[model samples]
Target: MAERRTIVSGSTFEEQIGYARAVVDGDHVHVSGTTGFDYATMTIADDVVDQAEQCLRNITAALTEAGCTAADVVRVRYYFPDRADFEPCWPSFRRYFAGARPAATMLVCGLADPRMKLEIEVDARRPG
Candidate 1:
């Protein structure tokens, strides 16, 4: 049987949220929606672009912990509270995703927390 692993970053909220950083099933890794809040500082950045960048950072950390890298990402979903915020952060997003360029979706949505302007979710695969 394939192993099931739960990725946790030692954050209490992770348990509260009832989700893991990533779950590995066979060759696939499914990462949950990650926010821009810095888990270390427990704070969210003020700027939308900065928050977006931080969201990617959090996603990267989660992926790394799951024995994967940005290059392995096959799909990405980005949630933004405001569509206008996307323009300013497009460059940063492109810079980070230049190599992977996973199938992506960007949308404007009301997030769980008011302080959270952006959230990122990803799916990755380990090469056979």
Candidate 2:
């Protein structure tokens, strides 16, 4: 069996919700839907674009911990509470994902916290 490991981001939500920020199984890494809250401060930005940028930052940290990088990401999913907020975040998303060019999808849906404007999830493969 491939060894599976969990990566914690020190967010209280992880403990309260009973989930890891990311999980690594063999060569694959799956990052959970990450919001804009900075785990250190537990605070989130009000702007969707800012939240999107922060989400990528958090995802990047998890990927790095899993021995991967944005370049290794093969798939990505974006969740937004409001459809109108999605386009405002495109530049931020494009900045992080242009190189990877991963398969991507965006959905307009509700989030756990009303303050959260967006959430991002990604799947990556550890490089050879």
Write model 2 residue lDDT over 1-128, tens digit each, in one string. 98799999999999998999999999999999999999999999988888888888999999999999999999999999899998888888888989999999999899999999999999999998
How high is each candidate's TM-score?
A: 0.92, 0.97
Instruction: Tell me model 2's lDDT, rounded to 2 decimals.
Output: 0.93
Model 2 stretches astray by more than 4 angstroms: none
Instruction: Enumerate residue pairs that collide in model 1.
Output: none
Model 1, 2-118: lDDT tens digits are 877888765557879787777888789998888888888888888988888888888888888778888899998888888888788889888877789899999899988898878
Clash count (model 2, backbone only): 0
- Residue 72, model 1: lDDT of 90
At residue 58, give the lDDT of candidate 1.
84
Residue 3 of candidate 1: its Cα lDDT? 73
The candidate that wins on TM-score is: 2
